[model samples]
Target: MDTSNEPHIAHKSHLPHPYDQDISHVLRHLSRITATGRKKLANSLSTAGYLAAGMWLIERNLGPDAARSACASGSRRSLERPLLGFLSQRAVAAAVAENPPPFPSRGGVPRLRTTWRSQSDFIADLINFAMWPTNYHPGYLEQRAVTTKRLVVGEDFVRAVHETAYLHTAESVRMPSVRLSLALMVLADGDDRVQRVLTDTYRGYLSSWKQVYAEVLRARGLRLRAGLGLDDLANALSAATDGVILRSIGDPHAGVVDRGRERTLMGTVALAVMHGFLEPAEDSDGLTLEQAVHARLGRPRPSGATRSDALRGERNPNP
Candidate 1:
């Protein structure tokens, strides 16, 4: 099979000696097992247990020689580096596979409308799509922000931002790929190579989201207040999102909700951040912030958009 187009977990030079092919075989087998579901496994397994399970499966299929080679002469540590990469790659692949072609609209949240010019750019988009929330359909925000002649800079814009934050927090709490990502994060802490990959992944994730937020602001003729910039809002929201996800992981009911109201923890933090940063653009047709927000909330949602619908074309919203 021509794997030239397939995403690799690591560079050729970074793979462990003599075990790279073996690792690939092992991963393929693991994928098959997960897909077939012929055998049952424990629902809760520690990271170490997960690793052990992989090794056991590999040994079972390829025999003790493969397992012994991986453990010999500090090769086990080397082997682990690619495993972390595999997890990250798998998360990305699973996300992409779930949300296939026709860019943007098939998935609940649109795939980025931008085309990637390089492998790095493409990988970054895959990672971004994997992490995006999926409560709203494609063109949901766009339909609201852009009117017949011009972009509407009012309540719809504010509500769109708030909805994005709320859905991101809500979906991330239950996303399976997020669990794998969290595990990968903990495992990458001491490994320099894996840490580099993780750092790059997150940088790309942040950059993609920054662009989305910036585009949304541009579409609605909004700007950051005073000294604030797009980067500030993106970074703040990113940090808050991380904190919320972590808190929600530990306490299932924590960050996903805000006092049982219609808002979310992330929504509150996002709005607070926006309050300090977002403002009407000078060209917003003389619409003040208060007037824009107080505009009626009765406008009908765009066609095919729904708050309760399942994410079409994907298994999980946040991958």
Candidate 2:
């Protein structure tokens, strides 16, 4: 009997360490698609209405080295447009056809049924909508705040995941300390506040977000982390102009920009979620390890170029 060809599967009870998980999942967008001439994947998701779990996985698996590939972008689109889950076992197998990860094999077995839910789903969604809110009413401003408020349901969702799926989200994603939690993370300062922050002037809010985040970091002094906090993180709340924040905290008159920017200064939130600044409320939307992987990662997109530019491919002779 030859036992050398055996494969191993990492169970939910044991996942990559939390910091590693964040590194691989969130930062993976910068990875190159592949050395075989693939596209570079986007660092974030397309329909960022919710945090794209697949993107998170890519950040975890791939690293800065893969950032140059365009193939990665296409893969992200594949996961984003339809909101589908992980790659088919065939797809995964096909990807690793020539050079597979040293990770244990599947023994020719299937990757098991996937459930596209996770503990980070809801608050992550809030973060998503906050980043880019399009197509809505003036009243949406009022409703949006309630939407981002951390849900009590997340706690039960976390427990259910622990008992049922056998998934092991890092403890950091589940915040144990509020002083160092996601609520304190800043999105933008002055011109950066995306979620209809009294859009009299866009530039001001975004600037305020940066200042506020810096203040929070200063105020909290490295004791916090990111995730859904007790505060309403979705409503573009900021410590920037208090008058704007006070007047617009629940204002029913505001515009949900049709083309909100995708990128945000959410590194704090990303760090917080990875470090347990946020806890699982009773109703956290549960996502399986599989769902998170698929949502956070992808195969990369092809270049839109129809004509190949030979000069572009060649190294700069001057350099």
Candidate 3:
């Protein structure tokens, strides 16, 4: 764990915390989960969407150092075409391999080949469609807002975040937090570039959870205690996730790699923290420790790179 090239937090100002007066109304996304099944469905979609995109990039040999160079403020946009071409080729190759078509007859008239679209566009559109409503009719929007208030401070928000962490650390890919830690090691101490990236990425990454927590508090007819707010909670959670991830990687037998232990632990901590800020709601999603263990162990472990094997850039077992 030589962290010489990684970034470290020397101070808070370089990575300023997100500060907003109130929760934004964007939590309309999570509001759609009225039933237990729907919540699970939404969470699954979110998990697959993020993991797939990350694996696709990593399989293409992208690494943190490469991402940092490409993600430079002005250079990211220039990568669209090349990245798209590569993705298109991979897509076509996969399609051909999985569902081979008959070759065209030499005597037949030439058929036009479809042009390749950027894989990034495909992913962006997929995520956008999944997140936002397709129809903006007044009636639909109104109904949406009504459904959005279902779980402001209960287990739904916590579960979504928990599932995301589970998926990121699944056996199929290298643990993302480990990757981030290594990435930070490569940066100069307190470098503005690293700080900017951390702040912007964390702000965007945790925005949904923050909004959900705010809505939950409002629904519970409560507000955060003095000196504690949604932003503070979010930053704390981020730190916790990072800390636990580092620990798990460094010590796999510490119960983190023990099926649902990690997810359950984080979820419990979140619920406890919420209770500290607001009154406990009667309708909390009662995810008992036994249930968490059952659910976690029931699923087949994801196959591919596990442990630190993927860190060395060996062949990825996942597509």
Going through the candidates in order, what is the number of backbone clashes in each?
Answer: 1, 91, 8
TM-score of 3: 0.37
What's model 1's lDDT at 61? 26
Q: Residue-wise lDDT of candidate 2 within 84-164, one digit each (tens)?
A: 122233333333332223332332213211111222322232233222323122444354333222111234423322221
The positional error of residue 285 in candidate 3, measured at the CA in angstroms, is 25
- Clashes in model 3: which pairs? 5-185, 5-186, 6-184, 6-185, 6-186, 7-184, 7-185, 152-216
Tens digits of per-residue lDDT for model 3 on 236-287? 7766666656666556667663475535345455566655544444543233
Q: What is the C-alpha RMSD of each candidate to the true structure, in Å?
A: 20.1, 27.1, 23.3
Which candidate do you rate higher for lDDT, 1 or 3?
A: 1
Runs in model 2 with CA error above 4 Å? 1-57, 60-89, 95-102, 107-109, 112-234, 237-319
Q: Which numbered prediction scores highest in lDDT against the true structure?
A: 1
Model 1 ranges off by over 4 Å: 2-155, 258-263, 283-319
Residue 56 deviation, candidate 3, in Å?
Answer: 8.7
The lDDT values for all models are 0.44, 0.27, 0.40
lDDT for residue 76 in candidate 3, whole number 0-100: 59
